[model samples]
Target chain A: MVSELSPTPGARSVSADTEGPRPPMPVKMVIAGGFGVGKTTTVGAISEIEPLTTEASITSVAAGIDDLSHTPEKMTTTVAMDFGCVTLDPTLKLYLFGTPGQERFGFMWDDLVEGALGGLVIVDTRRLDDCYAAVDYFEHREIPFAVAVNAFDGKVEHDLNDVRWALDVGDHVPLTVFDARERGSVRDALLVVLEHALATAQQ
Target chain B: MTVGGGVTKAGTTREVKGEDEMTAGEPSAADDAWGVEHPPSIVRPFLLTAGRIAGGDSLVPTIPIETQVVATDLGLATLDAFVFDQHRDIITICRQPQSLAEIAAKLRMHLNVIRVLADDLRADGQLALYAPQAESARDATVLRRVIDGLRAIPDSRGAIRER
Candidate 1:
């Protein structure tokens, strides 16, 4: 009996038993915040896969090159951003990118936000002004965004309404509380941002 | 040993080793010197086919967000659908245990294009390369560690609600 193996549909036949084609999947989201506002933690929380971090040693030699005014206590700096992924639905994938809070990393913002659908600007109520740069950056670019107030313990005692008023957030913008340390909160915050984006896009 | 030097149709006298010096029914010394005594006939044809296929390289078929099988199979269709619409036709196409060249060819795109797409896809966790079969243990361990780490991290929302 002459039996021949046939190529399966959606599968390619190659001679060498060495390698096969790679399936394609890519998605991105930006995590923006003031210095030390827990952007990295928010990403690390809900990331289904190993998060790729670009945090590097803050050497004195490179101090002059990059600004570290906001996060003076930070020993490491996210030179670019932290990358992670989560599957929201059967066909929806979410990529979390933690943007460097320092102004010197400004050059990277354009590239990082290239194809991003929207962003989460993590805020520390204690240092609300610190997040102004991120807010302005995203706003000026006309990118959809949500303000996630990362409430740190013993730092501030303000209601969510106060935060909204202080931040001058319009009613249309979604304001939510987030703990950079918790995965569910971060996930919720991300969802809020995504929902806000979807709503805005609909209009 | 009988010594006879004669130039025939080839015009070159070749030194023939005796059966005693032959191993596995062939000249052991000559086989060792040449590395391969007799190469399989299929090698040339295979290489030629590979070359031809790679000639018109374009871009590898990246994991189509809407059309990706892995995401659907893994029950991540919702996530895949979201990403697919946001970034249409942007994905890293990887053949299972595929060679760099084969991947490049299958995409029908340039090697650099495939490479960039692959890098992005890998960074995004949409594709993974299968290493050595024996390294499954190591791969599993690494995957476990990553999952554990993710699980250990406290959910940010919990902290927010507490305050």
Candidate 2:
């Protein structure tokens, strides 16, 4: 008889009753960038709750993938990851995860990147090269992403075109300028990522 | 299941992996007891998962769901004192649906640690993880809703808010 009941088609369900408060469908987006590029700040701006940090011990499973040039043969490196959430509706929620762009931390990115809608690779114009690793990883993995040049103090030293050329991201990628400090800007930037995610999903 | 064998009960600190039912150690007195004090900051993070570098890829369980969960009769029967505190906290908040990130934030524990604890509870049927049947990794409708929701948020401009 358990099999006789109709199951929900998309998400995995544990119980069958439909009238009570159900768990919201959890969807996530990633904010990837170099250190101090404001990934955490972007997540914090629009999150319903203050962002939280978690320490994860990333092991050597990523020896070949992560750029280990800085620390060779190191068995493990622990990093503090910041994340926040937005409730889109009673049944849908959006989670924003900020990831460190350092290649050594690429292994941990798997846990965050998988099943995510898309990514916003925040770039600091002053350090144009810092975001190269993120752009490479997201491009190679085929994850839909947008390059948001985070202008600190409402100031961008370089042209967005120059930053884009320096990163050498493909033409298909969406490159836009934004300030990470404002909630509205963060939300709009995420909207762009979601649009890209929607396009990819439909295809 | 018994918990805690080579445990050193020095103050409020104890190793959770040493007490997990899946781990090999035998159950001792402290295995089922709850620590009344906070664990010292010096305790290694891996000790919470019994020295396992990877806590398994079960982030799916942390997905927010609406199924109601009452703590199993077994409850915190075999949890270490510190783990029990977290377990009770989850049970109290989960009376209604909550996301894994919410639980972690409210409890002030690392998300990974909360993941391990939530998995433990699910394994024992002490917690029920309900995921929305209509949602998936790349659902078009869901993505659209997210985009709409983000757009609906009120605009913030002209002032630099402190983060």
Candidate 3:
């Protein structure tokens, strides 16, 4: 980023604007799970501002298109995600982006997690299978991730150990019980993910 | 299993060798003259990007979708020096600094489209991009800062005002 906002060609002096207010250093955390896993709820809980639902027009290939050079028509899928920002301070900002609700947008994950701090995979106790793909993606890429079982009604249906065994996550991955509706609960859950990522990286 | 995918048609396409994943293949000159379109809105995103199609991370360097973007003095002042309306919209929305994703959400454009357009504006000195550190995920300092920041946020029920 330019150290100083450029002067408007003699209209304003270089010193007119001090501190060269550039955008803050971005820190991203992915909130991923299968459909209806409270992924959006988790983001809204802790974000300073209202969460925004954004759509991405993803161009994905349909089945049976083997010859790339010969094919002309293409399929474009619309994927919508919910995201919100927390201003860590003036110099840093943390963004929570919920992965697209649908599972087919697997190709979008590489772009989402490449430079992110880590991931918080939300799971509803009854449907543990919804998050398997997310867990696999993060683990396979060696990106540190934590699992938060969203106890929607404040009543957790199963033990944390049961979820661990079901998800088959290693002991290294932090598995915690959290209520998706509470701000503190989601915040602590995210901290666990960051701590896990930090610890994993240090080792 | 693509759910409700809309398969759009394409005409003859020319390959564009690019330096980053933001790159999209150029629409062949024969399809339509480059930079010459009837109206900006409702134009196919690929055509709006002039048919520059980008793919996975393995192929090219990329800006993390969360990178911040702000308008330059020039961008804040005028729409001249830019061909695409998307560039102009980026400049206008960026008068106050915003993340690339926010801009995409505001502009209702695809993330890659915003990436490509923002890259163009930055190249033209119309916008500035502040990407996170190269190894941000592994940066302990950044992680510590984020952890501290999260700690500072008020977690009380009152902290969350209904939107």
Candidate 4:
């Protein structure tokens, strides 16, 4: 590469203090569930920045049966995705991406899960089924995940055991009740997910 | 006083007013080469990548990039004025290693489009890619650091709500 012009003002200065032996690597943990399952709230609670949003285009091939012959053909469509982030430290930043919970968008998970620490699936007891897709997707991918039943107004509509059984999460999954709006609760819930992630990573 | 969950009595009441709204469905616009008069449409994403549906490399959003030595032979001047501007802006911002996601967000360009353009720049040796060192998602030491970091965060409950 050749230098055409001087770098723009405010370019990061490579100094002894700023440059470390190892460059800071970005790590991400996904916050996933249905559309309104407090994904953004959980991110905002823990993120030092105001949980900025970024969009990614997701393309998936759709297979459908032919109208007359009952044959299968494929189609593709692109959709937008929203995400947020947290700066854990100067060396390691954590990103929290709120993915579409619908199964149709499952094709995009492969990209989202690459190098991800783990996932926290926030479930609303009133809409337990809303999070099933997230749980199933994580389980199938062998990604460590914790199901956090988000409490609304400090109330849990369903029993923890019942919610667990309904979700069919294995005993290995740490299921807990948490308040998404509370930073401490969200932080604690993420801790559980990290513990699971650590155990999984060690194995 | 802060509650155990990090919320102050006053903060909780104020935050409770807003629920997660599906505001993404709202029609949004972006500036194009022509300025604000012609807001970018949905098809603009395709145009950004020159109809290239796929990107070349595994440039994850988190990967960091920095400008290498400048190359006069990169033929940057031969490209469209708008493209040259985008490339120059990217090169300027990436003088110090910046994450790919931040570049996309800051530029207001689609992540995929950034990936394609960044890949093009890398191929021309104008940018250097610094991939994450984590070999696997389950790296034990990295996960431990993550756990410790999350635990170290002081009570942030209602404090964030007010902002």
The CA lDDT of each predicted structure is 0.44, 0.60, 0.67, 0.57
Q: What is the lDDT of residue A59 in candidate 3?
A: 41
Which candidate, 2 or 3, has the higher lDDT?
A: 3
> Per-residue CA lDDT of candidate 1, range B32-91, in tens?
111122222232211211222111111332221112222111122223443322112223
DockQ of 3: 0.19
Candidate 2 deviant stretches above 4 angstroms: A1-11, A14-20, A59-74, A101-108, B1-83, B131-135, B157-163
**Tens digits of per-residue lDDT for model 1, A48-101:** 754443321111212233344544532321132345666543323445667656
Over B1-163, each residue of candidate 3 has an lDDT whose tens digit, in order, gives: 0112232234212222211222122212121111222222555565655554433421223556777777878667666655566777888888877887888766766576677667666766667776665677897878988888888776765463221
* Model 1, runs deviating above 4 Å: A1-25, A55-78, A103-108, A154-156, B1-163
Interface RMSD score of each model: 20.9, 9.5, 10.3, 11.1
DockQ metric, candidate 4? 0.14
Cα deviation in Å at residue A113, candidate 4? 1.0
Better of 1 and 3 by DockQ: 3
lDDT of 2 by residue, A1-203 (tens): 01212243333545333323445666788888887788878887888877765443334434346555665543433345567788877657787877744544445456556667789999888887677767877887788899999988898888878877889987778888888878888877887787887888899
Candidate 3: where is the Cα deviation over 4 Å?
A: A1-20, A57-76, A104-108, B1-40, B57-61, B80-85, B157-163
Weakest lDDT window of 10 consecutive positions for candidate 3 chain B: B25-34
> How do all the candidates rank in terms of lDDT, highest first?
3, 2, 4, 1
Q: Give the local distance difference test score of model 2.
A: 0.60
Candidate 4 per-residue lDDT over residues B100-123, each given as its tens digit: 666765666555556656655665
- In model 2, the clashing pairs are A11-B133, A22-B66, A23-B65, A23-B66, B2-B27, B3-B27, B17-B50, B33-B81, B34-B81, B35-B81
Which candidate achieves the best lDDT against the true structure? 3
